[model samples]
Target: MNWRMTRYTYWMVLAVLSFGPEAAGATWHVDDSNTSAPWTGADWDNPFQYLQDALDAATAGDTIKVAQGTYHPDDATQNHTEGDRSETFLMQSGVVIQGGYIGYDNESPPPDTRDWELY
Candidate 1:
């Protein structure tokens, strides 16, 4: 192949790699205090009320940011059908669920700041 063609191919590969699915992961928010129903879980203000909701929507390479609160699988609205006590949160491969985030507050917009000790 010509040097120019080889260089063009390398740039094309780099562009694809930079914008691939693995490089374009999504971030989902989960907050127990969210009174708003039918939230998209796309941002902190309008977050998924249930942890399971975010989990259900998350795919590979996605990140689920959960607020600091108690979340039980039995209270799941999406994953658990019968609200069985034996139900549990299923951890997906390549998906990171990070907790200790201060979710929506009536006073101010929730911060992206995360501190496990001081939520």
Candidate 2:
């Protein structure tokens, strides 16, 4: 290819690599306090009850948005070793974890209603 074409292609490749696969991923919702059935964590209206459920349903580049609540790694049916730090709630590579949700029912919660808390 010509120099200009080669440069353009190089830049395109760089952009793709920099963004990675997660750039176009979807957002998943998790609310342990939610009583929604058939928990799929697909949307805020029907969120999974456990963080691990959302994580299991998520893929690389996807974001897991969790509601405010205490989450125990074991509560999600995750196998945990007492002292295995590496296995403790280890998130998928490239996945993003966001928390602090007011979890309003029936209607979508406003952005301002969302709050952050440490688990």
Candidate 3:
């Protein structure tokens, strides 16, 4: 293959691999401090309380949007528990986990501000 042909083939392969079967899907929300019940995790209005819950409900191409707060894997309730809590979070491939949401409400023209902290 010529130099140009090789370069074109390489880019085509890369594009196919990157945007192949894994495409952007639904977006789920998680607010650990949210006291509301009947969590659906569909949107910010009805967000899940725990990050794990969101992850569990997410698919390969889904995106999980987490609100600003400290989360502990050992705490199923997503509350602040004192002790040496150690747990692993199993993430699925092609799933995106984004944080730094200021509130549960999805405001139009979202404020250019975020407050995310991990403990």
> lDDT tens digits, residues 51-93, model 2?
8777777888898888777776656644554344455565788
Error of 1 at 10 (Å): 6.6
Whole-structure CA lDDT of model 1: 0.82
Give the per-residue lDDT digits (tens) of candidate 3, residues 53-109: 787788888988888777766545453353545676656787899888864754743
CA lDDT of each prediction against the hidden true structure: 0.82, 0.72, 0.73
Models 1 onward score TM values of 0.75, 0.63, 0.62
Q: Top lDDT: which candidate number?
A: 1
lDDT of 1 by residue, 51-109 (tens): 88888889998999988788887666654765577888776788899998888663443
* Minimal lDDT window, size 10, model 3: 110-119
Candidate 3 lDDT at 2 equals 100
lDDT of 1 at 82: 57
Candidate 1 colliding pairs, count: 0
Candidate 1 TM-score, C-alpha based: 0.75
Cα RMSD for candidates in order: 3.8, 6.0, 7.2
Q: Poorest 10 consecutive residues of model 1 by lDDT?
A: 104-113
